[model samples]
Target: MTPAPLTRAAVADMIDHTLLAPQASPADVDALIVEARKLGVYAICLSPSMLPVRAPGLVVATVAGFPSGKHHSLVKGAEARLAVDQGAAEVDMVIDVGAALAGDFNAVLADIITVREATRDRAVLKVIVESAALTDAAIVGACRAAEQAGADFVKTSTGFHPAGGASAHAVRLMAETVGGRLGVKASGGIRTAEDAAAMIAAGATRLGLSKSAAVLDGFPD
Candidate 1:
């Protein structure tokens, strides 16, 4: 079948409305959930402590290892299980970027497998590769690890990295590596409609955006 034309709503559905700031409070989370519902985005991505959002119509996603993938595999898995128990429908785990950069694909695979086993089918698993911090080879290897370990998505960044966030090149490379076997999420620094669309064009099936309202407003019909 021919692909359905990408519409404003179609793009909106691809969003994981995010609020991963260090200072975000319960009040802020409440407000985010309310706004997410009004905007009709796919999910609300938050820090694990803010879980159990209870947004009836929206999916709830939370981060595991977060911006830093330095946490031990056992710790990451425990964190993910906690988030899932707290009602997060999805868990975005950070892989050991240092390991990937060092060409240690075994360590990377082990990291993802840890969380994958913890989450099982209870929550969708997304492995954040911090792509901006990796070389082209590392990015490809990271994506391959995620797919091999059964991650549902391969994300580009944590938005907290000094190296910056998602880029079209990384997203395209990730897509090419996974070959539709996994989804690609372009996050961090994606603040404009054009940027979001470009990531999608490059084969991103999902987006993580903290500025959902503004980006959605800028999206063309």
Candidate 2:
């Protein structure tokens, strides 16, 4: 399917400029903020610790439960709250992959619920299913549970996972399952304009990309 024509401004609004690299310095984040402000992307995703000092003009986003969702639910909840308090407009929390693999639906639900409640009035919650690590059925189940837990978006991967990032099949499945109830964010490995367009065609309303400048540079004004 062909992607709908998106203007520069529209494409800018769809992007979530990401900066989750281990080697990222404060100067790097400052540069990221400058780019985000210039492009007017949807948000600037940062590590939780950086949210306190990052650009207040940009919609601040941080990951909770992180690449590995092995953290305790309470810890995730506290992290979400603290990020929001530190000026985060959005919280992307990882689901417990082990619990989902074990069919422990309660654990998955509780983990998401805790973080969701903690950020209820403060920020939007996007549940990261880490799609690269799961089977098709597991991905669907995780999206459903995230919706039930009151998440505003179901995100594909954390980009740090060994398995890889967003896939067309996962994006389609999430869109079909969530319908209009929630947003689908496709992150990881999306470096080109074509990749961004493809994900948007597959029903992703948001794109989390570390290479936002490069991607937009490939498109004409």
User: Model 1 segments beyond 4 Å from truth?
Assistant: 1-5
Question: Compared with the true structure, what per-residue lDDT tens digits does model 1 show for residues 84-185?
Answer: 998999999999999999999999999999999999999999999999999999999999899999999999999999999999999999999999999999
* Candidate 2 overall lDDT versus native: 0.89
| The best candidate in terms of TM-score | 1
Tell me the lDDT of model 2 at 52. 81
Per-prediction TM-score to the true structure, in the order listed: 0.97, 0.95
RMSD (Cα, Å) for all candidates, in order, is 1.5, 1.6
Q: Distance (Å) between predicted and true CA of 221, model 2?
A: 2.6
RMSD of 1: 1.5
